[model samples]
Target chain A: EAGVAQSPRYKIIEKRQSVAFWCNPISGHATLYWYQQILGQGPKLLIQFQNNGVVDDSQLPKDRFSAERLKGVDSTLKIQPAKLEDSAVYLCASSTGQVQETQYFGPGTRLLVL
Target chain B: AQSVTQPDIHITVSEGASLELRCNYSYGATPYLFWYVQSPGQGLQLLLKYFSGDTLVQGIKGFEAEFKRSQSSFNLRKPSVHWSDAAEYFCAVGGKTGANNLFFGTGTRLTVIP
Candidate 1:
């Protein structure tokens, strides 16, 4: 089976700029997730979706970050007016939508906000 | 609420030697735990997870972890480290319902020397 797919493997932009990352989860997977990994740190959950609705996004920076899984298949995460602190790797993952299921991840999109 | 702690920031071990990485969590009741490995510029891969049943769980790439409820710890272990075992390891905790979950640690960087 194909693994989760993320676009724009890397991106660099000046502060205050906007950037977006796209993700295509593995086929048949119904649960999608977005995570951010800063340097020297582990991935932190940003948002989670079950079908087309969001299940959790409490940790997401609502003022700057927004994500959506419109069709409940592919998803997108956007960062507006990116800050230097936003420089990190954005990872996408998918699961079989069952409780305690294993999550499969993508290659991730590295963002460098200058 | 759930939280994880990785006591070690970095660990260096000689190849072919035994390895163990420590993890601790804070939660009111039983928690679902997971270990993931991330290579440079790549996404995370599941090493293993503990929900119930077994205290010692085996994972991919010759990795294994033992869940100790008495100590509130889940540590990864390997009998013989391989060169490719070098990566960043993260420990996460989640809820039993599997929604709005996965609190991760800062992570531990592992380096294997030949």
Candidate 2:
């Protein structure tokens, strides 16, 4: 089976600019998640979706970061007014929905906010 | 709020040597724990997870983790290290509530020496 797919393997932009990353999850997977992985740190959950509806996004900086998973398939994450601290790898993953199922991940989009 | 901690920021192990990575979590109820590995420029891949029953859980790539409720620990282990195993590893804890939000650790970078 194909793994999760992410576009724009890398991106660089100056502060205050806007950037977006796209993701296509694994086939037949119901749960999709977006995570931000800063250098020297683990991936933090930015938002989670189940069939187009958001499950959780409490950690997201609503002032700048936003994400949407339309049609419950592919998803997009946007960062407006990007700051130096926004530099990180944006990862997308999907799971089979079984409580014990493992999550498959994409290659991720590494963003460098200057 | 739930949280996870990986005490080791980095670790080096010779190829074929045994390896162990420590993880600790803080949660009020039964936790769903997971270990993920990220290769350079890649997304985070699930290594394993622990929910309940049997304290030990097996995972992909010959990885396994043992969960100890008494100590609030879910440390990962490998019988032998391989060069291909070099990567960043993260430990995460998921809440059991209906939403099941995950909290991740800072991560541990593993270096495999020939």
Q: Which of the numbered candidates is closest to the native, going by highest DockQ? A: 1
Residue B27, model 1: lDDT of 91
DockQ of each: 0.69, 0.59
Q: Model 2, range A22-69, lDDT digits (tens) per residue?
A: 999998899998988888877788988887999889889999999998
Docking class of 2: medium
Model 1 complex DockQ against the native: 0.69
- Give per-residue CA lDDT, model 1, range B34-99, as digits (tens): 999988877888888888898999999999999999999999999999999999999999864753
**Tens digit of lDDT per residue, candidate 1, span A1-114?**
789999999999999999999999999999999999888877888998998899889889999999999999999999998999999999999988888788898999999999
Query: How would you encode candidate 2's per-residue C-alpha lDDT over B1-114 as one tens digit per residue?
Result: 888989999999999999999999998888889998888877777888887889989999999999998999999999999999999999988766422466789999999999
Best lDDT goes to which candidate?
Answer: 1
* Docking quality level of the chain pair in candidate 1: medium
Q: How well does each candidate reproduce the native contacts, as fnat?
A: 0.76, 0.67
Whole-model lDDT values for every prediction:
0.91, 0.88
lDDT for model 2, please: 0.88
